[model samples]
Target: MKWEDNRESTNIEDRRNSSNYGSKGRGGNMMALLPIVKILLGTKIGRIVLVIGVVAYFFGFNPLSLLDSSVTPSSTQSKVVNKDADDKSARFVSAVLAQTEDIWSEVFKKYGATYQVPKLVLFRGSTRSGCGFASAQTGPFYCPADRKIYLDLSFFDELAQRHDAPGDFAQAYVIAHEVGHHVQNIIGTLDKVQKAKQNFRSEKKSNALQVKVELQADCYSGLWAHYSMKNFNSLEEGDIEEALNAASAIGDDTLQKKAQGYVVPDAFTHGSSAQRMKWFRKGFTQANLESCDTF
Candidate 1:
């Protein structure tokens, strides 16, 4: 939680307020078309003549050019920009990301494999992505297509307020977990899982495989924690507890019980609450990639 003065990440891409509707800028052309349509349709002022004039106006024969893509968007918040985070939460995320890039790059070097440092996208509302479109509702996801991590900053608020995990370390765990997916992608583990899923006839079996993947990511996050604590002195009073609490709070069982007033182990995609904490602790204790082989 002591990350106020830490260095900010240069790879942060902030896209907080972008609109998906094409033809940007207050929907001006569409708005203009609507009123014209109303007048032409409702009245009988030589509808054919109106159509010609309307067509001419919409086709750039009009005085104002409303077709520019740049002017179409009503706001620029959704396009990545360097908006000053200037806050404790945002600053901590940046530092954690930079640290992961360092630790993972070195870890990969030991195996003689090149490590690709992933970009961290900090967005609000929604934004376009190579994998498709990402929204705040998508939570945190890693796109294998682009090798980037997409996260909505509001997720920290969700962790603190909804999950009862309100520490800087808890947020860092989330980031590391997503980065863990990137690790899997870089190492070909994720591609193998996808192939296995294709042949898996039973949905239940595939879900089990997914749980292992999720748990492995948790373990990988712990591995990062071990090094981060050792190298950066990132640990503080109750940091691990905060992460454990978060792990438990978002467990499939816990979330299902809360949402449906019941628990179903058979339907869990992520590991059980206990499993999540166990694997994370395992990684933290072992502090190596060999220790994270949950497969």
Candidate 2:
């Protein structure tokens, strides 16, 4: 993964230190009361009270309730801070993102279509997304609604220490996989699958569809890898192995077995270890977009 000298993407939004939940002040305290209100409104009596309160407020019957001084709104501000250690990871991610943009732009040109680059968001703890509130626990995800990829750099440490998939290339593969989702969104694959999922009544069928989506993204990641290596000679000796190991480590079977000491094939939203590795290899060896049709 010789990416240090490569170009960095300008589409990156770094919100690593921003607090989306709220700031620790009067506004924060008021915002923090929302969850409690939601919980209380979950009950029948509380719902009735809420309805009455709303009605009274609209009729000006409860002016004091509407003019609560403690519920003042405040603007949320974000502050950007860079840590020395994270700077290296940020550069690597930016480089990988830029490479994907270049490769995919070329690939799309061959198909008589223009590629629209997606933004990449680097955040920590929690952040607001078009899809919803996101946290590091949600892992890396691509929100088609916003056409952006969100990531937490700390996941690299978890990938290395917990998943046993150390190496810069493995990290690159993760970014590529999410970018692959953006590609699927561009090519209408995600739209078709999502439409089909709407008619699926069974959880098993839904999960199966999700598995196909995930595997295809994996193959697309490999497609990027294939061209990246061919175009820029970016791969080192163990890079491919690092990516394969990462695919295997995060497979549905491997993760489920580790979490619950059992495996449920029907619950697999992603494929098995063998399936993930095979699809990735298929795209890598074939070195073309046609080889990435997991559906």
Candidate 3:
């Protein structure tokens, strides 16, 4: 990927130097509460208490009163880093975001709609998100509630060293896929799918729907790649293969099999390696939004 000299996005929010444990900083209160909540939820007694709390809520009891009010949450000041022009990773991310902005803007113009750019948040360890408290373990995600993309640059290292998918374009593909989710949010596709999920009684069905959503994002990433290639001649010799390798590496099936030594198709939130690669290729070759309908 030839992105070094490209334009960097102004919509980036750098929160990498903030403490993950919720010292006095943005979203500190929520961040402080999440770990306690998680620990409580991990126990059987805590689960019972949670159920009782829900039951109390139905009976007109205020569950908020159960929280300790004496513990004052203090805010920590965040030290934003890499503001200088030489931060390679941050620069690469901003450049990729700019490309997505340009590509999607043109695509939306053709459809007689204006594109609203989404903010890209760069954080470290953990951070507060509109969706909920986010940790590095949650990976990269797009929160529709905030219309922003959250990422930890450490994940790129994991993508290279742990997942064995290295290369600048592989990293770019990850950003593009998350941006694709922002596009879905803009087009009301995410809203419709979320509404449909409300009626789904089976976890399998819900997972299938999620798979479609993720695959569509993958396809949209390819659409961006197609346009980027034509518009800026951004792709190098092995860029497409790098992206394809990344898609394959992060497939739900691949991850599941690695984690458990078996595959559970019904539990897959994202598609299989073959499906991901296929959809991405479809969008790359077709180079049209209509071809990205995974559902």
lDDT of 2 by residue, 1-295 (tens): 8887788999899877554542234365556567756975999987887788678757645322243543212122222245777878888899999999999999999999999999999976667678876666788999999999999887888899989999999999999999999999999999999999999999999999999999999999999999989988899999999999999999999999999999999999989999999998987899678888887
**Model 2 reaches what TM-score against the true structure?**
0.81
Among all windows of 10 consecutive residues in model 3, the one with the lowest summed lDDT is 70-79
Judging by lDDT, tell me the better candidate of 1 and 3.
3
Worst 10 residues of 2 by lDDT: 71-80
Give me the runs in candidate 1 sitting further than 4 Å from their true place: 17-87
Candidate 2: pairs in clash: none
lDDT of 1 by residue, 50-127 (tens): 677668867645422343443323332233334464244466778899889888988899999988888888776566
* TM-score, model 1 to reference: 0.79
Model with the higher lDDT, candidate 1 or 2: 2
Error of 3 at 21 (Å): 4.1
What lDDT score belongs to each candidate, Candidate 1 first?
Answer: 0.80, 0.85, 0.86
Ranking by TM-score: 2, 3, 1
Identify the superior model by TM-score, candidate 1 or candidate 3.
3
Weakest ten-residue segment in model 1 by summed lDDT: 70-79
Which regions of candidate 2 fall more than 4 Å away from where they truly are? Answer: 22-82
